[model samples]
Target: MSQRQRYAIIGTGALGGLYGAMLARGGHEVHFLLRSDFDHVTKHGLKIESHLGDFELSSVNTHATVDSMPACDVTIVALKTTQNRLLEELLTSPTRDGGVVLVLQNGLDVEADSAAVVGADRVLGGTCFLCTNKVGPGHIRHIDYGRIVFGNYSGALSPAAVRIAEEMVTAGIDANATDDLLLTRWRKLMWNIPFNGLSVALDATTKQLVDDPHAVALIEKIIQEVHGAAAASGIEIPETMIDKTIDSTRTMIPYDSSMRIDYLNRRPMEIEAIFGNPLRAAKKVGAEMPRVEMLYQQLKFIEAMRCDTC
Candidate 1:
């Protein structure tokens, strides 16, 4: 077992709640910065339903804001990228000097934005391959898979990244550490770009998307575009990865993507981080992705419509 470290979870959503609950159950000191569910979680604690098993923390260290939380050894920033503008205050407030800020959100180049607030040396990018969701307040349903890949954002082997991975592994998560941050981001985006965007655009599940012939063809085009973008950015993602992702999704439980779920619930989706940013990056490097560009424009329209109604 690894030594237990103090951990703080900002944005107690599906990702944050699941990982933080696992850590707290493993005997780590886990504090949660919650907004609406602070009272319910503080009273009823956190409940996790996983295929691995089910567990409930009768009580956890909970706070409504970062100011009320204590400095911790590592802070997991799991907030959706849509809420990233709030990260400066959330990260710098309760994170101690030299404390690790593990960014466990989705999208490309996300770590750089957070690293701007927390030092690059203190930021570690994390990619989660978990199928999980917050079924209700203080409750999470882990559908399947819970592996994490962490990378040093400072271009070196980060001691903080290694230690944080140890803690995650100790808590029964499949965790690994890497030295290449940009490559990690690009690789994760390979899966995120096609599945997430198409899921929203088509209003379909993973199985539904893969089951359609036209959808399958469109998915490949998006993957190839992402491959080109990654190569132009000086990161090479194998073309074989596209087939592997398709094969894996065929076996996955029919699931609505995060973007699709967000759109259904009328919450803001992560259009800019996942599509707009990557599209702009590819364009800057002279990579043309007409399909991806079309998807970006459509998402932008949906987002604008949502905001106008608000």
Candidate 2:
């Protein structure tokens, strides 16, 4: 592996732009697979402002379509679940080859989706713990800690994974490769399933949701339900993990969940991938998820209404 791995970020949104800009600024050869806004990004460059600091990149390689992009060693996918079909197109397109597709998406089904397109050996499970959003075209505004966790789903950490972790660390972002990749993914889901629904349903911030008595109780109920479902499915999640998630939310009180932002902006939400997957797993385990199911239905209805209005 070379000291600097060539990186291609698939979705140049908030988290993707942040990390891509960081790697490019750190002297790595980075390219951004963008959409129709490629000309705008190319003209103005990518900008990122965060609680940790601020940085900008002036010479970012931007591609409007994957068909025009060069083959890279690693491709980081930061798209929402609704965009998975598009990702399928990219992975199956002639432009794709033997590169590792690191999915930094929310929800638990990223591996399954990516594996269907690219082989399991080429798919990596990744989760990003950060509060970030696009404040403008080609600009990402980060609000909290930015750390990336990734690993192989087959329980084997490849040398490529290690090299990617080292490159992320060199860019001043914390990255960890773990043996228990599935467990880490489920843990992150536990946080997203409850908090994301509550944030969207109530239009509340992380602090407000975790601080309110009724909201806190609701979140706890959802967490316990998810934990029960996970246990039934043969995943061991520590009891203390729920409390730790709550504490983390307390510190990130001002931060708004991505679901909330998506709802406010009238964008498609990840209700199915984030909430529906766990609900289905719970059903498979014979565990009841009344509250979680109710929220899921509510979000679906909300999304329907948004579409109807448009």
Candidate 3:
């Protein structure tokens, strides 16, 4: 990859739209794969209102299908894990150009899926600490933190990873390449397994969950359970990270997590990807995540019931 590489954003929702628009704004050639927003974004382009700044692209290169999109150097998979079944087709479009595929979704072993399609050498997994919402067609509202930590799924850092992170930094994103991809993933899960699960299971915002004594206790237990699983998997998360995740959420703006939003809209939340995968991984490693299991069960039940009115 060059200093200015051609990029394709596979899922142009909140994450893709915001980061892809930022890349375009930073003067990179970005192609967006949009569905419902294809016509809207083609005409109106993309819009992002962020704490860092506000910007819009009046003329965006948009595509409605993977076959229609041109080959690019970096293809970002921002689709929800629920839509991962569509990845093999979408990724082939960019990998044909001999570019790397970055899996920018949540949960463990996500990159493995991408690696299976594109080969591990060409696959990178990124963890996003970004808070954003697609407020309208071609519009994204940035709420809080917007940092991305990415690493090669096959182990060891590569020059491409470094260059890509540097390019994103130039694009004004807090991006870094980590040498330990799996361990970094475990770190990310420290926050995600609890918050994303509870947000849907408890039907509570980050603030509300952290504010209530009972919720906070449950949240802590879930976090510890996740940490235990990580340890069982041979990746030991630092002790201090537990407190940091809690403090950061307590101070950040109150917000509804992505899973919560999915539930509220009656869309399928990432239950299997976020919870099922980790639990099974833990079980294989002989680790029992009773609290995390409870939370996962609660979310599964809520997922079954949240659509009762439908």
Candidate 4:
């Protein structure tokens, strides 16, 4: 077996916990830098109920702060963009020279922020196509689909990206590496723009949106706008991805989007990253995304209300 790389999970939410646990299970030295659930995770360790399988780590390295953790070969930043203000402090501590920072985040231009702290050469963008949630402290429920498509922010796959992809594949994650990170980011935005937006704006789950014909049509319209936006920005998303995304969602387990979950939990939503940033990027290139713009406005209002009350 190839040597396992030491990994640090910067956020122990769904993305961090699931992937970090899999890495630990694959025999990698994994350290989880936790926060609110630090005591629980420290005592009971990590627990995951995944479609792939159920697993438990009775004893794993857990730390409350980055300063308490050892430097690692790869650090996965899975924090929601809402908490990104903390990145300037949290990103630099747990990585070593020549180590890579893998950003498993949502929305556009996320890696650049990480790159600002870590050199651009040491950063990789990982787009996760999965339905998993942290149901409780130290516990995550993986609903379905766990494929992670990796791309380099520098426009070409680097050795670090390849090594991380190989490690993920060994850990049982459906992983792939792509050369065009911008194209890959646009591809992810194609799905994220409509579903995450409508799911929160309309107060519905993935199933509800797909089952209703009216909602389905709206989704298609939003997707068309996204395609135009991508093209306006010089990135081309295939026309067929719209149908494929809708069909895939139709078959997914009745799941609450991360945005919807945030809405229900009264936490701040990731409006800027998922919707606002994409909208600005589109408008800069002369693309008119009326549907997306409207959704963005609604979400902004909803985000304000959620924050005010919570």
Candidate 5:
């Protein structure tokens, strides 16, 4: 952006709070759009407990509503995909002329919603390889990995995108830009399809799921199905990605996935964005994910039952 652009974070949850706090701590002007923690954050500010190092921002710029936030050069959407319906208002409020919407979310075929608001050329996608969650109001616990890979939804990596990645690095984050958005999404799904789904389906933590031999085999099957789906869509995810993802998880701290937390907290799960959308993309190209499809339906049923009970 021009002359060190301003930033606005739409969701003040785990990923959003961690990123926005780092940016603000790195001497950037960041306005956080908050719902629940507005009073706490606006008063006590944000507390980030990270694996790298712990830090706190005692005074932060926070707003309760989107309309109250200033128009910024880059607006990061760190919300779960279940809330994409608000993209129309969320994308417009914090973005000024020539500003871009950076989507730090999961799933495929999802950027179209942001594009529909701000035009395709101005929508960027970020794949977050971070293990983080909100432990309490305005407090985030970042246990492992905080690297972000950014790419333009229009398949053109702009100088602004690279600048944003570099700024993230300046904020003590590991980040970079990529030309292949689709490839990055597919690679993420390779890990999400198995760990996130099984975490909820079996009611297990990442360590629990990866520890059992039988469960590991099942995860392998789900990964293979996701790989096949990607291949049919003309995206070639490396075969070694499977082992790499699983191996990385083995070394990760025992944790619950976002889906597991959602299910437990009675919050909505992002089944459509994480599972359904990818399945449909594969279906369009005559690819089927029997294993992943079965898991998807199970999640849908669980989600429906959970909502009904709640």
Candidate 6:
């Protein structure tokens, strides 16, 4: 393979920890910029358990803040959508230079937001297709398939993006760089928007949501609305593709959506990033999306409830 490049993971949670650990174990120089959990992670390294297998790294580099991070070739940002502002601060800090920020976030607008801070040339778009969770400090549980679709949003295929994808594949993580990164992000959001919100609203698993005929039809309606909104915005998502996506989810392990997990734990929800954006896009293009609007409002109300409880 190519010479091992220096890399850093900005968020040491489920997705970050799993990918970072695998890359480090493959002998790449890897570092992590974490928050308050740095001490525990440093002392014990990262532990990953998956249906594929389980493993632990004996020594993994970690820092609590960006001020302490060393210059690296690339930084994979696995932060939640709500933490985008904080990520902007970290990316703009002098500690990062001559490096690309690969965003492994859930939503679609991260590329534009990151471009505002670090310029479009330094930002790469990526979407992770996996079901994993940080079960505890230093422990991550991988629930299903792991794949990454990434590329430069400006349409210029950068050498860095290609190299990163190669390294990830070499480390046993399925990854590919695409010229149509925006479509990939939108496709992932199509699944995340309805299922995530409905799961939170009903306190159900993916299987539970699909099993209820009424809930299943509701999800299909939401998908149709999203498909319409996307087409209106000049992003054409075929109707048949939606059915294929739902079929893919059926094979995934029965698990609670991230939104439900966050709600149960009283953490901030990503309603705005996931649901609100598409609705706004629909409005921008003069498309009506009443069902999407309703779901978005419901998720917003849920967010307000969580805040009030806090």
* Model 6 segments more than 4 A misplaced: 93-95, 308-310
The numbered model that scores best in lDDT is 5
Report, for every candidate in turn, its global Cα lDDT versus the true structure.
0.87, 0.83, 0.89, 0.89, 0.90, 0.82
Candidate 5: tens digits of C-alpha lDDT, residues 81-190:
88888889888988998999999998887888899999999999989998998999999999999989989999689988999988888889898899998989999999
Q: Which ten residues in a row have the lowest lDDT in candidate 3?
A: 301-310
TM-score of 2: 0.94
Which 10 successive residues of model 2 have the least lDDT summed? 89-98
Q: How many residue pairs clash in each candidate?
A: 0, 1, 0, 0, 0, 0
Error of 3 at 141 (Å): 0.5
Pairs clashing in candidate 3? none
Residue lDDT tens for model 2, 1-310:
4567778888889888898888888788888988855887999898889887888887789988877777777888877878888877775542247678888888766678878878888888888888898988888899888888899856589887888888889888889987777677788888898889988888888787877999988898888888877888788999998888888888773877889888888989989888888788779779888888999999998898884333
lDDT tens string, model 6, 1-310?
A: 5679888888889898999898998789888887867889889888999866899997989888777778877888888878887866776542267888888888767677777777788889898888999998889999898889999968677898999899889888899998878688788888998789888877788898887889888888888888887788788777897787777778778887887888888888878778877777779889887887888888788878775443
Q: Model 4: per-residue lDDT, tens digit, 1-310?
A: 4568999999999989999999999889999989999999889999999999999998989988888888899999999988887888998888888788999999998887899998888888888999999989999999899989987888578877888888889889898988887787888888898899999999998888999999999999998988888988998787898888899888888889888888988888888998888888988888899999999999998888776443
Flag clash pairs in model 1.
Answer: none
Ranking by TM-score: 5, 4, 3, 1, 6, 2
Clashing pairs in 6: none
**Candidate 3: tens digits of C-alpha lDDT, residues 1-310:** 4459989999999999999999999999999999999999999999899999998899999999988888888999999988888887888976655699999999888887788788999998999998999999999999999999999888699888998899999999999999988888888888889999888877789899899999888888888888888988999788788888898999988888998899889888888878888999999999999988887888888878775432
**Model 5 stretches astray by more than 4 angstroms:** 308-310
TM-scores for all candidates: the values are 0.96, 0.94, 0.96, 0.97, 0.97, 0.95
Question: Residues 1-310, candidate 1, lDDT per residue (tens digit)?
Answer: 4457899999999899999999998889999999989999999999999988999998889999888899998989999999988998898877898788889988877887788998887888888988998998899999989888988777787777787888788898888998877777888888888999888777789899999999999998988888889999899878898888888999998788898888888788888888988988998999998888888888777766664322
State model 3's lDDT: 0.89
